[model samples]
Target: MTEMSSAPTVLVGAGNMGGAMLAGWLDSDTDAGSYIIVDPSPSPTVQLLIDKHGLRHEKAAPSDVEAAIVVLAVKPQMMETALPALTGMIGDDTLCISIAAGTTVSTIQSFLGDIAVVRAMPNTPAMVGRGITGAWANAAVSPAQRDAADRMLSVTGPVEWVDEEPLIDAITAVSGSGPAYVFYLAECMAEAGRRAGLDEDIAMRLARATVSGAGELMRRSDDPAETLRKNVTSPGGTTAAALDVLMGGDAMQDLLTRAVAAAKKRAGELAG
Candidate 1:
């Protein structure tokens, strides 16, 4: 259990990712009373947590609040309106962490002045508390504030801090968008199974289960994924036969390399 912080933590959104973090914090040792959720329309899940924990929920941002951390979880599109309204929440000691994609630290600093800022990119898996966040903090952030932000984000998953802010786009290209690529693999595998005479339902189930099980194994084992693949492949086995086509001429590697490159390029464009 995390030691509870007496100072309030202002959460500016209550959507999927935001709601997941909120739920995680409430379930942990963090004081339930320390949260202040600011959302015009809170999701049922978020509202339920608020009611059950006796947390504060306001339709509009409060001007008189002095919070320890101000989490900017609203969508990038809504940030223009949200930042201006929530500027008062950024006191001298407050640490501002923005989870909104494509919003740079400079933009946030412009709106809220030179307060400590941590910009983070958290993926969809955060909804299940299995996400990994790539965070980058500006020079103004203190060590204590960095630790505080890390503890807060750990409720969702591990935190990977990078010194170069631009590397976040690469992280965005990889883990942030990586889940969809895995899902697409499952979809492709299911279709291939159907073409191979398996029932559509059975094929889909097999594909989904295989992908998830392999992911779990990778998580539990210290072995690298390449090593795991080698362990499964015999001198002349069916798995090797399949890998021959997949790995032949590095087809899979080349495709994914190009795909991630494109994603990173687009991320830079969006951020600009």
Candidate 2:
């Protein structure tokens, strides 16, 4: 188990992502006493965690204690109203990690007054401990603070750091919003299968299983995804016939490129 600082870690939200992080920290054997959950209305799962762990629960940010780290898990839309209330929890040495998408570091600093900050984008898969994070730290963050951010963010899955903050929008497009794209693919595949004469339920089941199984295979294998795709596509085989449509004239690539660009554009608009 990684040792946390003596000062408490203040969590500002207890919604899905926030609750998932709390679960991960507890499962990793972090000291329950070191956390202070500050949510007005925690979900049933979060409330159960609080009761079971005997953690300090507050309806709002407590003014009495300075936190070692404060995790901002509130929604981007709620950030303006929420951040001002938590300013007292920050100290000179405190590190603030914001997982609120499209809410820029400058926007956070506008309220918190230039403290060490790490802006992160984590996906829904975090609930299952399979998420990947893209993080960018401002100049104020020290090496130690960055390490702490990494440790905390890595609880769900791998954490990838970027030098430039604008890349976060790209990361958000590619991975943060990527899960929905995969789900859409599954939907499309299921519909196609149904049109091809399979029962709707069976088609959905097959699509779900294939997507999940393929994802698991990609996770466990050392080979690149391209290598795996080629390995499965025999000349003149069924898989090859399918790939001809997906890869032909880069049809799939062009479609995804346009999709990601649209997402990135929206992320920038949100940042503003």
Candidate 3:
């Protein structure tokens, strides 16, 4: 494995997503001594990890240390307030990776100045080590730095790299916000089942299990989702009847397309 760097990695937040990433790093056997956590008020879970690993912790970015890698996991609205203190930790070779949604690379550089920056979007499922990340690196990033970023980001799951920055917004619409969509699907499914005469608790259980099980099946299957759908759907059968409603005149497709577009548009607005 390539050494990430000799200098310590400065993590600027320890909220849910930040804590998840930190836990993944330690679980992957990353040197606990190599991290400097800079959260003012870490959650109990994060505090436990820090104490367990004996990692260095600080209420704010320390001026004495120059970071090789910096992970910004603060909220978008908090970036302005949080970033200024972190400027002292960045050096010429520092690779900054920001996972906060709607915060652009240029915006980060504005505070930290021109250095390597990789703007990434990772979903909530990362807390469970099953998330996917969409990442874009600026021109300043070196190959080694990019590889290091990939390794750190991939601890949760797959990392999808995009050539253009704008595509990150589209990814935000899809996978970044996709988990909530899945959850809402389960909600709708449960309600439908309840209306169809199943007991409320039983309907919810069925919906939850069905959604999660299907997701697992897709994860393990080599065949595409369409093929899997077709495999279970017999001609003139119950599955086909459901598909007729969902697929008829592209109803689902159009609805999802419009929904994704709206999300992407809002992401752009937030970035600005």
Q: What is the lDDT of candidate 2?
A: 0.93
Instruction: Give all candidates' CA lDDT scores.
Output: 0.89, 0.93, 0.93
For model 3 the local lDDT of residue 263 reads: 96
| Tens-digit lDDT track of model 2 for 184-212 | 99999999999999999999999999999
* Span of 10 residues, lowest total lDDT, candidate 2: 1-10
Q: Model 2 segments beyond 4 Å from truth?
A: 1-4
Q: Decide which is better by lDDT, 1 or 3.
A: 3
TM-score of each: 0.96, 0.98, 0.98
lDDT of 1 at 124: 86
Where does model 1 exceed 4 Å of error?
1-5
Q: Mind giving the per-residue lDDT tens digits that candidate 3 earns over 144-262? A: 99999999899888999999999999999999999989999999999999999999999999999999999999999999999999999999999999999999999999999999999
What C-alpha lDDT, on a 0 to 100 scale, does residue 235 get in candidate 1? Answer: 78
Count steric clashes of candidate 3: 0
For candidate 2, report its TM-score: 0.98
Q: Model 1: which residue pairs collide?
A: none
